[model samples]
Target chain A: MTENRDSIAEIDLLAYADGRLAGDPVRRAAVERHLARDREAARLVADIEAQNAQIRALYDRVLDAPIPERHRDALWGNAERGGGAWMRLAASVALFALAAAGGAAVGYHARDGIDVPSSLIERAATITPAEAGDATFALASTGRERVAGETVNLSFAMPDLSAFGYRLVARGHPDPGAPNLVRFLYRGVEGKEVSLFMRPRMDPGEERVSTRTVGDVAVSYWSAGPVAVAMRTDDPQMDGIAVAKVLKHAVDFARVSVPGPLDEAAPLDGTGAQMAVEAEAGTMLTDIHAGPSQLQ
Target chain B: MNDDVKWMVERQIPHLRRYALALTRNLDQADDLVQDTLERALKKRHLWRRTGSLRSWLFRILYRTYVDNRRRWRPERMAADPALIDAFASQPPDQEHRVEYTNIAHALDQLPDEQREIVLLTAVEGMAYDEIADVLSIPIGTVRSRLSRGREALRRFRSHTEGAAPLRRVK
Candidate 1:
């Protein structure tokens, strides 16, 4: 009996029992043939039927109960708000305090032409990398000044990279919904102010690295080195090469360990590879790195 | 979003509660489980994607919540009262045999939680094997095997209990 039982595919019997198997006439017939002769199998089938009957009798009443109204109301309530306003205000205040503390720490570095502290560089590194898509990275000077009718305050210790022909600028907020935007404001020669906004170029099978004009600002934009760096400035004469030179120098100064060329770097994981493919597909470089913690 | 979903949920709540009652054997707990499942469904409505039947999704939530709650809190078992059994026996056979139903319930209670779930989802709820698979996140093959084993266990239990007791007279 056991030897003959080996011929019966248990899954087919189960599926036949559950009524899920379809279009496989051969296997279905095989199971039916075995069931016809086997008394124990017949008994097993009866038992299953009885159990099913019992279960149906037990739970058929649940279908008639009323759905509570509160459940639907809660769903809409939770979904619409991005985050509470109080939380956002608290975060802004906390950020200001952190900036003040950071500025005091980096005050000596700016006064004396010494290397910026490692902590300051690391703090700046926390800002999304420019190659990572539309996000801004800024290293604000400890000095405060009014800009565009708003009193802009700086807190981070600025690196004196004037020798490299790149000046650190007053940090400004990036435009919401910009695919790739980075703002770094700095006082250039003769106290002239400049802001760098770099946005990555759109490309296929590769993340875009490009430059374009935004209003009066000449932006140097590129998607290379796993970040999108955008240097935006009001200077009409400033071109891509000059902006790129300044960005490269500033990023080099800020980056603790520069990554090697793309080919040498480890391949991206499944999610990262998917984002890279999307980037190559010319989908506007959406912020892919924002995970659950950044939901607010 | 459709009237069909609203209609289905409205029509199916009683059945869901009855099944949940059978599963939990506690009226309050059963209702709580049903409520929790509905709340979860409402929150995750965006993920519905209109791919599968809504009942399967609802059942999946109910099953998972029941399993999780069982793990978190030990259920309080109600002892079978001899007087209640006597009263059930005094009732006419033509009436739904409360004693027999209680016997079946007791037998179901003895089965492992996983086996009991398979039994309830398949036998009681009239869910397709594919629907059960989707609800439980198990393969169809596993569902079949589990269902077979669960039925066999139930049969043995019912038979053993039946053989031990000749029809006792009501006091």
Candidate 2:
């Protein structure tokens, strides 16, 4: 609005400050000349640029943070789970389930006294091989436990922890009442426990993979589509995030749909206690055994 | 579904994530937005027209998904997410200026959702006015005015918060 040709409007000056006026050299030059003479105007532009820098510095690194693996697996994984007529219905139900589950879990835990993380861990730790007999029908054991409305895959392939020299240890008996939570435990060379818990989420709202330490145990949790998965370990050095991602990727897409375990599919719900020792012929067995610390 | 579309969508993910981060201001929320956007785009990949810029198309989907979710989780929550802000606020010791940096996060957070979206699209993603209009399905004039008001609002916020308690980083 300034009559003087050299003077700049606030909008034009701001645009110029943001490098948005690059296509208009004449106007930009006028603003530059005005700022050159008016230290006040130059200071405004500098302040504006500084804000821009702060905003960029705050967030741009996310672009560099390795894309969380579950996200990547959703895009590229070969085994697809949720594309059925059931999936469309399950998608809405999953969302509803998520919110309902959260509310129910809070109320249920308050009333029935189900400790979410600990009970899950403790129960998994207590279940005997005979108790985990459901893993025998590896997939069926999980599939059979589904609630009437639950249609998503409830079981996941045991993550090939062989890369870290860990072997299948046991499958925990999910509380019959809260049958959604499936636990697969693995053990390292020294018998350290690493448990992967996979549950088909009814909650549509589960998004981020979060990690926390319960006592000395490190727990990492995230959701992929209809499934929510978490991996827990006592090993402090295991990048819980990376391992959680691996498990999430497996839980979401690489679920072993056809029967047949790594060695022999747990006979419909008579799954063995120590699976690594029972690993069937042709089951993958990685020779490179390293502690969780060597995951990198 | 086709390889080219797949590759292009994959490449735009970083840019989408960056812009989403600027809008959501929470890493978890931002990544979730990107993931949701990608899922939708892939599911409806057949609807994609080869005419306009792929970036614009992807951004359009992303913005729509974000708006839909925000509506579902209505009453916009611009709560101070220290987890995200502190990541950047952990910069320098120039006490006087650190105040402005802190205000920067507050200012962006406080901006109305539309203004925040318009401002970040222009400032972070460097979208042209027309491109923004295309992304948000608004006129170019609305884009220009919203952006102008957004910048002024930010400046006002910084000034108002000046000399307040020293901003601190949390983890």
Candidate 3:
């Protein structure tokens, strides 16, 4: 335990104990001879080994324990759904669409008589799925989203949702007033669509999170630091509150820039089309630098 | 991407699960962490291509996810009480190792996360100093320092305190 030259350093003794002393035989023998004289060093090595044995004894059983059903499904369920390669590719594409479209839509929704940045995830009154049919979450045909004759870049911050049994499907803009708004949609294992609506915070405020269920659609909304996001899904097992908590730190603010104005909205496939209504949220993000009342 | 690499990943699940269980001490949460790591690793499988050690890469992701969850929800750890020291390698040991296991698990939970992880990787997984460095993304000297600190902290439970049974004398 002493630091002196002849006195073996603790780490050297530990290395000797861990059997990493093979690097130098002379040093290893010297350390062993040192241990023969030093009772403390020998005892210390034994205790360290004992601790290791005890830990292995405690948790190594998990090596033989049954893998969980959900994880198993995620790993090998590719055949039933699709190949893992195809699903992963689809996941990346879903991420890109959410980044662009979901941003423009949420920004516009928060600016309209809505107290954004804080309560953006709490209040849900006017927007409904009944009106969601007409909005075309259209591809601008140029590979970039265009808003009002100017091409806009939308970036969405989304965490990988595969572990939670979800994948990205499509995006939509569900507002009668704002055609430029965008919303990204996700499909659960059961083919139910989970809509994610996001808008960048114009005036950064304290983070807020809240969950509510309307018409069997569980919605979780949270605004943290730079952006506000809302996600709604119909899966009975989908715990909106839990998902929102994870997402509060998980989602990144989508970046929206206007090279042009809004064009189209898309419809998502679901179970019997029990559409979950979320605000058209992407357009007003450009207004973050446009100052207060800019989007109005 | 290929079958061989896919199989290699699948084989590490049980080992990953064990390390995770030791970290969280909860079966469900540990498995959830494992699930998340596997999904993310597979999704980003290309990144793992050039790494010299797959286990190190996988474990790095595991602990990273564990700490992320810890930031959101840190399950309260039992404070290390120097008063209630117990022997880990019992005298006249039984087959189950029940008493020794509980005492050590409790002792381990008391150490700080950084130290606990270093100790567990070194002790439980039998990882060498270099592998510990890779797993933690820390310098080897730092790993040694943390290990020394952790061992001294944990040794109190085994080396000190007056308890029911006497520790078997080690030569």
What residue runs in model 1 are displaced by over 4 Å at the alpha carbon? A1-6, A9-32, A62-296, B1-5, B71-74, B79-96, B164-171
Candidate 3 lDDT over residue span B5-96, tens digit each: 45445656787887776777655677888998888777877776432456677888888888878854254452122221122122323533
- List per-model TM-scores for chain B: 0.80, 0.81, 0.81
iRMSD (Å), candidate 2:
13.0
Considering summed lDDT, which 10 consecutive residues are worst modelled in model 1 chain A? A269-278
Native contact fraction, candidates in order: 0.27, 0.22, 0.32
- Which residues of candidate 2, in runs, are more than 4 Å off? A1-7, A79-296, B72-81, B88-98, B163-171
TM-score against truth, every candidate: 0.43, 0.48, 0.48
lDDT of residue B98 for candidate 3: 47
Worst 10-residue lDDT window for candidate 2 chain A reads: A93-102
Kindly list the per-residue Cα lDDT of model 2 for residues A64-96, writing each as its tens digit.
Answer: 767676566656566443323322321121100
Q: Tell me the deviation in Å of residue A261 in model 1.
A: 88
